[model samples]
Target: MTSTAAPDRPATQPRAPRRRALAERLLDTPLADALAGPHTVDHYLEILRPDWAVKRVRGEILDVRHQNEDSVTLTLRPTVTWPGFQAGQHVELSVDVDGVRHRRCYSPSGSADHRTRTVELTIRVHPQGVVSRHLKAHARRGMFVGLSLPRGEEFVLPTPRPRRVVLISGGSGITPVLSMLRTLTDEGHRGEIVFLHYVRGPRELLHADDLAAIEAAHDNVTVLRVATREAGELPTGWLSGRFGPEHLRRALPEDADAAAFVCGPGALVESVREAFREGGLTTPLRYEHFAPPELPEMDPDQLGTVTFAASDQQVEGDGRPLLEQAEAAGLRPEHGCRMGICMSCKCRLQHGQVRDTLTGEIHGTPGAEIRICVAAAVGDVTVEL
Candidate 1:
């Protein structure tokens, strides 16, 4: 049989070997033994280009714009080490402030299915947030920051796609859900999407223009802008106040089988969850929290001494997280997020018991790892830090 190549098909080029192959080949040479190591090489490469590293994933800021008075959005071009992310995933971004490195978790506010090599992060600049304030005040195009691979799979869209989706977010929590909405729209999703976002006022809304455009362009998408503070200022069709059962009823049809996703403050998430439960809705309800869960009140007398096994230091616990106690005692253990979500402050429980501040459960398994950010000493405790 004879066949002719299609005119629309372009000629393909052979794929080149990846950086790992090149590194392996270089390391096999005798010159590899003469250098200090990969660390020295990485140091030299970083001197030439901030994003150039053997294994570390770094992103260079390509654009920075203030979304509003309290928020800034950054467009980043990550190094090839980045593996990309799902629509609803977040990354641990690390940046240097003064002389100390601070890390925080942030979700990308862009379409995951978009044909681009960049990601966008919309950060709300809290008055006490070190990283957020630094990025807002000092971040410039071409500056580099460290990035962890994408994390969190709980809030991603369902694989087969549901017939209807309900997205609820408040304030800065719109980031991940916005990513999901953008991805679904880019994929030409046919399902009905009801997006309800709550903000203090119009001035606090992020990506207001994009949301308006998306709602106008897509017939299947319904966008509701709710103003909690300036309720009287909202438009006729806009919503007023926070989320409640009535809002849920307004968003979802009585007989509709819809999957719900919520990302926002603890109160908003809890209210959504409670509404779902009260309404007897069986469809999936997934949520994400940016802050640490509220801990139950603890008695100061119940808190005991904490011993750092490796550091050979001890400190009297102050009814706070072990990580805070460690910091107060002049020990700098590696940590990220400081909210127990990143798992970067996990340490071994050498002895004694600790209480999970989030769940109020006590754990005493020897040698088991515990997240120091959310684990408090039940009594006298020993930890491998």
Candidate 2:
């Protein structure tokens, strides 16, 4: 008694035409075409990427040097750079821990010897730090990680500012300040500059030899380190421990008015900025907000579906960040400092609006978007990924 037609075949459903890739969209959308041009396709391809999908080995770990009990220096093999970085710039290290994608932005512990393409990172291990712990415990030679080209404008020397410059850093925040000092000295870039760094003890210091060599070679460059555990007079030998607005002022040249660069954690950076302002510093002040520890307080469970888009990819992080989940899924997006301070991970927003933690602006780029790190889904959404 079976029907000859096989009991009515399921109605055939037609597959909707595939939407164009972001590169194709740029070519099709005249507005975006004019803005980004034929180069837009390349730009889209370059920016819209999954961390694992497009990430390639830039270099292998050359060697590991221990700074003290909890600090280590990793020397990387040769890397490639395009559009040479300015005197003061930074690089983003893309790493993975137990299948979870994590990115950390570390300032060069070495100099701008691009020929070698080798950079060193002085990492102080935090008990709860993700990347630091993983690298300190497991990373080894020949292990490869993705690194975004060097970036950051906040560290650049100002042309209109006074010749005298004062650099301030605390704890393990001396990385970028070290880069700036080395660049200036290595290139004979002149102007009186003094670096004031604060640390817990001398043993935890980074690049002691390099810093000393710079100070000795350059008459205009001075290095002052405040090691709290130094049981002696104020920084008599290679290091010392004293840092604050008072110390900063004392270290400056006769020209009290000079550009001041600062780096470190949020509270430290804010405190230094306030102190500098209170001192009536008219010179251009710049700062780099170091990578922050993951906030366990962020409860993605409370959120609804979050949608996001990029050039060549699309992503959804359920109620969380598309970038994070996408990274977990092995998509490598170009990002510098994931704190949303550097904006290197900016992406296109094709669908739902998002609220940015840094700016608190509701964003839906239509075909554009905001940085992925500090943004959250406001509602059900779709993105170019």
Candidate 3:
């Protein structure tokens, strides 16, 4: 005979009903009505406790560390309501710059340790990126910012983990891979790990000290770094040029069953994919890129029309992203991670065909959900926004 035991709830779970009753009673008071006449509960809460309580998923900047001239890492203490995250997932971060709110997605470059009540994000300031520039230059401790729950499943390790793994990353793509490495090291993973990373030069290296520590502490770990901008002094048989087929072939582990994870720019990711396909190294390969893969130039005849059913308006699809088109047409749709990662701009396609700008694949199924940040219309289409 088998006995099944019920699960135990947290100590705070039992207090929720009591809290709800208290809240109801408090709202019945005349002061509550006076507060509600012109403002919302969030406004009153902000007035009572400005820095801690927020209507959205919020976090306070606890510390900042500069990893390189172009990048900085921020340690954030998130609200208690934040559901925990996996190692390689990303979160949408929102900051207000010059009275305009801008949001972007960034993967935390550290372990998801809930006990510490903190997560870290490493961001590179792009040339023309306003929010990135603000974060790198003016962001300081005690500043509160909005955060989304962890997202993305494409570049993560599989369950029942592989005995041997190869991780490849280029430039800022090292962020998510760093999270995976931190998680593995913390959990005492004894499997063989070969990490190959590429950067412009030594100055641009991300998480250098951490990688060095990992290599020194674990006998099963190996680190190979390549520099693209280094001048005439090459180590014997080491890579010097930009990442290419030769470099990838040298970095691939000898084990045929090893899983491979790659992240980088679209060109780098595609190049690695092609190299893997040609080399017959078919152990499960996963790759992610911030930008869409390059597609052939859109012909003038390929342009289609997009209609918004709710607005009774239409616009010509110029082969750009649907989000850009919608914004140009004066529709302020909720969106985050404009790189097609967060899926915040997803909407139902009521009719006609749409092409994915990333893979150049056409999707036309009725009532299909489409990510507007990366999809473009192929013909006359209607989207329920």
Candidate 4:
């Protein structure tokens, strides 16, 4: 006869505490980010945590797509703590290579879709770019990386979406502009848009498929391509005729309140700015630069000494960036982008003058925040970092 009473419950396992389980699942354990000191816990256990939860904002490479011959687009999945970014904004990505964290800034190339908990960054490998090279060569699906909150103000979607918009992009500078266009398409922006991309050849055209898709889907979208190499008539220095006042006038909507965003190499951005000015298009203009503009010739003899007060290190400064100097002295200082765009290497100038390596501007005011990645000490200096 079968026993009516419940048989011995088959070795049921005890359930973990709700709060503890949640904390572990989210990688929100306290003191997890601290690198040293006895107060830190679970520092060694980080390998077991989900990539997105291990730091302030961690992300894992969900997918990678080769957009063209020289560029690759990476899809990243970040944790919930990542402050949602606006289209045309950039974030700092830190990848650990051989136990060293190398950081760089990249604009998201995907739509600002927070609901999907995903973003994309398209990167082109620079000759001396360590992070870009590694990401292109080795970073693959499921690789965990560190990230900073989105930071950038010069290129964001303007409120009330202007009646007309023109997007000018050069080479790989299309990354952020692509994001803005995708977002506008998703939001059903009713404004007329003129997008002009300048590339050396059709193979060099980044996001050609996406641009074609946007043009096919939206009636108000007009996509134009200016292949500089193909247009041999243009001067060797700048692609002036391809995107000048005449071109703008012909391409942009007439007599409509318009806003223009220019992104790309320094020459392209500057050329577009001049075109806008010459055309007398008194509309809002925004720009983002992938590289520093041509700086005035710096004096080779003008060098300084940099004293790291906290690290108790002193090093002779060269015309190179302070970040590079500090590294040469065997002191590891936090930095990103090395281009001064991300503002990740910002530090206080305790006492001395520093020169902006990009714009050739001087900052003698002590106690001001300076980006060490692009600022060189002008004379004897002391830094708080």
Q: What is the TM-score of each candidate against the true structure?
A: 0.87, 0.62, 0.82, 0.81
* Model 2, span 1-385: residue lDDT tens: 7666754453433223233343344454557646767664334534553211211324468888876768778887633323345556767777878898787777776666444366677777879678888888886887766666777776776655367878888777787777777766666667788888877667666777777888888888888777766665544554554456567566664545577888776656766777667877666678866644333333464355554334344444454455676676667777656677667787877676776554456667576757778777766666656
For model 1, the stretches where C-alpha displacement exceeds 4 angstroms are 1-40, 51-54, 254-257
Candidate number of the best lDDT:
1
Error of 1 at 191 (Å): 0.5
lDDT of 3 at 303: 74
Best model per TM-score: 1
Global CA lDDT computed for model 4: 0.79
lDDT comparison, 2 vs 3, better candidate: 3
Off by over 4 Å in 3: 1-47, 50-56, 113-116, 229-238
Candidate closer to the true structure by lDDT (higher is better), 1 or 4: 1
Which residue pairs come into collision in candidate 4? none
How would you encode candidate 4's per-residue C-alpha lDDT over 106-158 as one tens digit per residue?
Answer: 99989985554798999998888888888888878988777789998878988
Clashes of 4: 0
**Which residue pairs show collisions in model 3?**
none
Show model 2 residue runs off by greater than 4 Å.
Answer: 1-57, 79-84, 95-103, 113-117, 126-130, 139-144, 158-162, 227-244, 253-257, 291-336, 341-368, 375-385
lDDT of each: 0.85, 0.66, 0.80, 0.79
Root-mean-square deviation (CA) per prediction: 4.5, 17.7, 7.4, 5.9
What is the C-alpha lDDT profile of model 1 across 1-385, one tens digit per residue?
Answer: 8566774354542234456568746744546545846545545666887876655688999999997778889999998778888988889999988899888889899888857589999998989888999999998999998899998877798888888988899988899999999989989999999999998888788999999999999999999899988945576677888888779887787536678899888778888888989888887999987554576777776788899999999998777889989988999898876766778898999988888876678888889999998889988999998
After superposition, which runs of candidate 4 have C-alpha atoms over 4 Å from their true positions? 1-46, 49-55, 114-116, 231-242, 299-318, 328-331, 379-382
